[model samples]
Target: MTANWTTYRELLLPGLTGRRAVESELRRAVRDGRLRPGTRLPSSRDLADQLGVARGTVTSAYTQLIGEGYLVAKRGSGTTVTAACSWPDTFERAPDPAQRWRFDLRPGLPALNAFPRDEWLQAQKVALLALSTDELGYPDPAGFPLLRAELADYLGRVRAVATRPSEVVVVNGAAEGISLMGRVLKAAGHTSVAVEEPSHFGAADMLTSHGLEVRPIPVDDKGIKVDVLSTTDCRAVLVTAAHQFPLGVVLHPERRHALLDWARAHDGVVIEDDYDAEHRYDRPAMGAMQALDPSRVIYQGSASKVLAPALRLGWLVLPPDLRDTIVERKRLDDLGTGTLHQAAFAQLLKTGGYDRHLRRTRQLYRARRDALLDELSRVLPDWTPIGVAAGLHVVVRLPAGVDDLAVQERLARRGVNAPALANYCRLPTFPGLVLGYAALTPDRLRHAVHELLEAL
Candidate 1:
C-alpha cells in the first residue's frame, strides 16, 4: 500500500516566527500525526499564501526540520519528511529565508522542467541495447570517441567553431575546462590572467583558487574595455563573448577583434564560455570568438544551461597547442564523465533530440523572459532593467538610495527570492536584482514579481 502523505499546516505554524499565538497550534499539529513521513510539504508558494507570511518563513521552517533529519531530498523526487527528524521544542528568530527562497531569481540556471525526459530515456534505451560488454567497462580518458565526434559536428554547425575531435577535450563541465586551462597556461609560464570587471565571480574564484592573479578590466556598454587589456601584463583573458553573465551584453565586435589581436601579439589564450548561445531572443546569434582566432582561443561549451546542470557534461575545443596539456589535465580529474550518461547524451544529440529540446526550451524561456519584463514594467516602472536582449536573467537597477540588501530582506519577509546584484559584484556598483526567469512558470513568476514590488 502507498503511504498516505500528510499536510502539517498546523504542526508547521508552531515552528513559525511571527505568531506567538500559534506555538501550541504547531505542536498540536505534529503531536496529532497530521504530518506523515513521505508526505510532500506544500511548496513555499502554497504555504506562503496559506500562512499569510512570506515564503521565506515557510522555507525556514521546512529547512529547520530538514537539517535535523526531518526531511530528505531524493533526486527525481520531491523533498519529504523523514521519520528521524526532530521537531524543535522552542522558538527562535525565523530561520534566514534568504538562503532558501525557492523562486530564486539568481542568474545562470536553466529551466529544469523542460528537459526532454522522454526523448532522453528513449535514446538511452537505444544506446544500451547497442552497447557491447567491452563498452560497459571504463570510458576512454579523452571521452567516448563517438561523443567527441558528434560534438565536433554539432559545434561546427551551431557555433561555426572549426575543430577536429582530436582538438576537443571532454571535461566534467565548463568549470573543469577552465581549471584545466588555468593549470596548462600556468605550466606554460602564464601566471597572470585578465577578467572583465564584474566578470563571472565563479571564474575569478577558480583562477584565484589556483593561485593565479586575476586582473579586472572595466566593462562598458560596448563590453570589456580593451584599452585596459592593452595595459595589463596578463597572459590570458576569459570572456563570455556570446552573452556575458549577470550583465547579459555580448562582447562588442571591436573588442572581440582587439582581444584576438592582443592574444596573438602576447601569445595569450582567450577562454570563451559560450554556454547558452542557443537561447538568443533579440538578435542573430553571435559566432564563437574562437572562430576569429582559433589558434589563440580555447572555447568551452556546456549542457548545464540547455539540458540540466546535474548532467555534469561539457566540452572544450582547445587550440592545437594546448590540446595535449588539457587532455593530460582532464585525465587526472575524475578520469572522465559517466559512460552511461555520456552515451545516452550522445545518442540524444545524434538523433536530433537534443536540438529539438533546445529549440522548444528556447521558445519557452523567451516567453518567460518577456513575462518577467512585463511584470517588471508594471511593478518597477521607475527602475531600469539592463541585459534584457538575451539569457536566463534580467538585471533590475533599483531606484537611487534604495538599499538592495534591505530590499532583499524585506522581500524575504514576503516569501519571494531574489539576489542583489551587489552580492555578485566585487567593486561597489548600483543596487539591482538579477532575476532568473527560466526555472519559473508564468503564474508563479508573476506572483513572485508582485512580492518583489511589495518589498520595494
Candidate 2:
C-alpha cells in the first residue's frame, strides 16, 4: 500500500504542467484509488522534473494537499495519501449523475437561472456588515425577529395572510414546517390528518412517520372535495388551495368557504401549503386561505419556488394556539434556523429586492410555460393541459389507455426525468405527466416535446 505515485509518473504525471493541474491529478488519483491509502507521492523535485512543472508548483500543491488532509507529509516518511482522503469526484463526467438532466422537466423548481445573484450579494453584504456581534449568535427558535416582521408584512400585503411577526416561524423549508406540524398534531392526540389525493408523497410520509394516518380526499378541477373531507374522521387536513399541486387548479371560492366550514364544524385545522403562490401568470393568485380564518388555518409558504431551493428558507404563519408549542419543538429540532440567511433575506425584503426578483421571475416563468404549452399543443394535440397558468409545472392528461409510467420509463431511457402523475398518488387516478419548464429555454422545450413524442 506504500507504493510511490512515481509509477504513474510515467503515464498521467507527464501531462501535468501547472500547480493546479498537478493538484487536481493527485486528487483524482486518490479518488479513483490509483493512489490508495499510504501511497507515497513523488518528492516535489521529482514530480516537478517528471511533469516539467516548477519545483515550487509541486511543493505548493503538496503543501495544500497536506493542509486538506489528502496527504500526510513527514521529514523522513515523505508525503503519502491519507486513509480519509475522500472527496466527491467533481472531475469525473460520469454517466449516471450527468444523465439526471437529460430533459430535466421534473417539477418543483423555478427559473433558477433567473436568481438575482448581484442583488442578493449586495443585500447580504449590507446586512452582514450591520449585524451586531450579539446578533451573530443563535437566533430565536421561532425566527430572526426582523425576518419574521418582514415576512409577516410581506405575506399580509402580497398573499393577504393575516399574521403579525409573533405568528411567524422560520423553517429550513416547507418540508420542515410540515414535520413540525406533524409532531404538534401527534402530541395533541390527533391520530389522523388528510391530504389532497395526489398531494406531495413525502409530506404524507412525514405525517405517517410521526404516528399519524394520512387520509387522501380526492380533488376535482375546483380543488379538494370538501364533502369527502367532511366524511373523514380526521381533525386536520393539508391543502394546496392557492393552486393545487400536480393538478394546478385553484380552489373555487365556494369550495374554499365549504372547506373552512367543515373545519369549524369538525373542530379541525387546515394546513394551507401556499406553494408557488408567487408565480401566477394569467391572473393574480387568490389571497391565502389563512386570511379568511387565521384561527383555523396554519399557512405555510417557502422561497423554494420563487427563489432557489438552495436557500432552504420557508415560513409558517401559525395561529396563537399552535405557535408557542411549535416554537418549542423548533427549539428542540435545530435550536434555530441560521441567522445569517434570515438577516440577509430580511434586508432583501426591506429593500424591495425580493419583490423585484419575483417580478422578473414571474415574466420569465410565464414565457417558459407558454413555450412548453405551445410545443406540447403542436406536437401532441390530443393531450390536454390541466390547472391554472401558474407555478413551475404543468400536468397534461394523456389520451385514454396510454400508461404514463411506461411513457415515463421510455422518456427515462432517452434521458428525461419527468414524473408520471400516478407517482404522487396514494390511489390510482390519472394517466398524465408533470413537466417542469422553468429551467429550460423555448427552443429546448420545443425539442423536449419532440423527444416526448418520440418516446410516445
Pairs of residues at least 3 apart in sequence or in different chains that clash in candidate 2: none
lDDT of 2 by residue, 199-296 (tens): 87779888988999989999998999999988879999999999899899999999999989998998899999998988889997899999999999
- Candidate 2 deviates by what RMSD? 14.2
Instruction: Give the poorly placed runs of model 1, Cα more than 4 Å off.
Output: 1-99
| C-alpha TM-scores of all predictions | 0.78, 0.79
List, residue by residue over 52-137, the lDDT tens digit for candidate 1: 66544444454334433444444335456555434455632233333345466667778877888899889889988878899898
Relative to the true structure, candidate 1 reaches a TM of: 0.78
Q: For model 2, where is the 10-residue window of minimal lDDT?
A: 91-100
Instruction: State the displacement of the C-alpha of residue 445, model 1, in Å, after optimal TM-score superposition.
Output: 1.3
User: Which candidate leads the pack in lDDT?
Assistant: 2
Question: What lDDT does model 1 reach?
Answer: 0.74
TM-score of 2: 0.79
Which residue runs does candidate 2 get wrong by more than 4 Å? 1-99
